[model samples]
Target: MTTSTAAPPPPPAARAATPPEPPSAGRRRQRKGSMRRREAITGLLFVSPWILGFLVFTLGAMVYSLVISFSRYQLATDTARPAGLANYEALITDPKIAIALGNTLYYAVLAVPLEIALALGLALLLNSVRRGAGFFRTVFYLPKMTPTVATASVFLLLLNGSTGAINRGLAAIGIDGPDWLLDPAWVKPSIVLMTVWGVAGTMVIFLAALQNVPKELHEAASIDGAGAWRRFWHVTLPLISPAVLFNVLVLTIAAFQIFDQAFLLFHRTTGTGSSDASLFYAIYLFEQAFRQFNFGFAAAMAWLLFVIILVISIIQMRVGNRFVYYEGGDR
Candidate 1:
């Protein structure tokens, strides 16, 4: 038995080899890489249209404007001659340009803050209402949906000198209203009034922003014995500040352009074709290039305005970081 066991102890020399790992995981890695490559290619294809459009259309126009700004350009003929800084020099000394700038500044100063305050107040009031909230919101937003032409026309009829509703209403109240749209002294105010009419959109923005503000924060303020105004100053105002800045920037630009309203309103008011009175920058630029055939000067004015708006926007953007309270941003 011992001899047989000793013979059996000479064990098998062949050992089982490790089975080769399935190729599935290596195949999976290759497939994953292929998928990632496909996705990247698809993303690039998606953005191609925008990239092409900007290069061919938008950037082209912007660059063309810059080139023409330094030259005397003729809109009627496709001819342009280099004029260096002559057009810019003219704008600097032009009395009409100075007046237009002043008027624009005055309009912005009067309208921007008033529009914001009014819109914010309206939003707050709308927010406070429990019933018929949707109705009030619709009513507020209706004027914004109206066409600019239609709104301007309505304002013209309502603010006209003699037969206007405002003066008639004033007469009924035993007080005479001054010729609102006609008087140069009152023209800006009239524009301001019309400007306010279109503030419903901005109010809606503020309303939405206010609604997003934390109820818990407001609750805390209330628990801390804060009054309405105090809570608004402490919590609500800070929360909606970014919206305020956005509206201010947009309205400021719109105020500077001041075209459609000024065009329709000025023609109706002065009947004088902007005659240096209601000549805003845009109106003046239009008169120069289209009406007066001073394409060069118009280009110069356009460039100047572009620069002014750029500078102002940059300044506002820089300063906004100081005051604008963005939720979840690095404070």
Candidate 2:
């Protein structure tokens, strides 16, 4: 009773009134959500044409072919009749399939390494040139721009048995040149030579890779008393190994699917070439589909080729990952 009663304290709700939300934060959240939605829509719209084309043309054709591979598709009647594993079984039993596959493997093994080496050499040469590099690059890349049909025609003339320019040049050097197109032993090599002509594309790829290599690394290596060869082997090659791996894979696949040049050079009415040496898998597949009307078998062959390419590519990537160096520290 010594003093008057203290003023009553404020209520808890009045003392702890909730703070209003920051107006800018709520607006920012809304803006971000709207922006994301807009970006997603725009991305879809940009890719719509490609998606439609792929679904209608590529994916649809692939599915139809897969179905046909299980049936005996008759182009004459425009019909497909189920035959189960017969087409697949024929792949195992067919001798021509084995032969064609062997030839393809041989060509891939021979051509891929040669093309890589030639492309790398050309790239190094172009990189070393201080003058007229652009002109030389254009001249070199001209072969890649030349149409396949035209290249085949040119090679057909150049690889002729007796009077070709290649043989004449060989004769001038006191070396006997083999008949490139006509002889069984030389048929694949002839194709390999033709394949090398268009390695301008591969060269350009390597050139870009070489240009990307940090000059500082080269200088550092040089400062460490590294010679040219040592610098290339240790520093330059590791940096460009990815490009090498890429070109090797692409060239190998192309070699496996070797078709146009072989067909143009050696195709006959019988669908057999000089001793079947030039009867590549693609040629055989084309013959099965078009000439023999074995659509089912051809489709099966196409699938088989695709599987082989897929498996080989996977193997290359697995092996390449071990050696290929990326600047981003990713395999």
Candidate 3:
């Protein structure tokens, strides 16, 4: 009684359950490999400029400096002659080298810690801001934007012993301020103050690090009866200690190479300012290279500084690794 058409001949065997035979394994791999090669070529092209610049400028200059450090450069003939170990020996025998190194060391010791603390404090305050944070950050960062020459000119006036704003302020507060620029004891401190004035860069770095910290850690600590101080000490400080280490290492290196502010503040064109107190290693190196035309000695000094910085950086990384907490494990 069924007038069926036999179900339309069973739908033609359902098309054999095979997916168009996927191009073969070798062909697929070849296509993928071609794509990767193209990607790699594009990446190399994008980064080629930086690589070229590093090779030509930084590495080339370093190599040139290292070569000249062993020879006496004749400015008249624009040539260099072998000088044996005279330049390296002078590094040890020169009295000015010691004085310059001592001054630089003192500045580093004073500036690095102060800058870290102040930068961290500013970062904390900025991070806590719920309103107009951008404006506050911009205002705080203005000092870092300021040109070194202009900053020096302004501080030269502000630090004047007789009628400077700083002394005036001190006097108003019933305190006597020292001769900031003139006195040997205060000269380094004055430079440190100028160095601190441009600490907004470091503060911004700290602010970035602080913002990345997990808020849940603070909340958990708080729930566990941790006061603000305790929470900050136990929860916040450890999380932020990597940033602290970074800032410390960078500031220390920069402190060693301090030149612009010291030169502008102390070694002006008029030949005024305290050369003795502000005679940093860089300043001395500059004088040797350009002023006295002792290029070999200056080059030697540069190499010595490079070695010193390298050693210190190694020591810092080793020591810092122990204290710096890595949320994802040790880097």
Give lDDT: candidate 2, residue 249.
89
- What ranges in model 2 sit over 4 Å off? 1-20, 268-275
Output the number of the lDDT-best candidate: 3
TM-score of model 2 vs. true structure: 0.91
Q: Residue 220 lDDT in model 1?
A: 97
RMSD of each: 8.2, 5.0, 9.3
Model 2: per-residue Cα lDDT at residue 237: 99
How do all models score by TM-score?
A: 0.86, 0.91, 0.91
Compared with the true structure, the alpha-carbon lDDT of candidate 3 equals 0.92
lDDT of 2 by residue, 154-216 (tens): 987898878899999999999999988768999999989988999999999999999999999
Score each candidate by Cα lDDT.
0.86, 0.91, 0.92
Cα lDDT tens digits for candidate 1, 1-331: 3554435576678998988978998899999999999999999899999989999898887788777878888878878999998888998799889888988888888999999999999999999899999999999899899898998889889988899999999999999897876677788888788889989988999999989998999999999999999999999999999999999999888888888888888754547333555667788888888878878888788889988988988898889878988778863
Q: List the lowest-lDDT window of 10 residues for candidate 2.
A: 267-276
User: Which sections of candidate 1 miss by over 4 Å?
Assistant: 1-53, 268-274, 329-331
Worst 10 residues of 1 by lDDT: 268-277
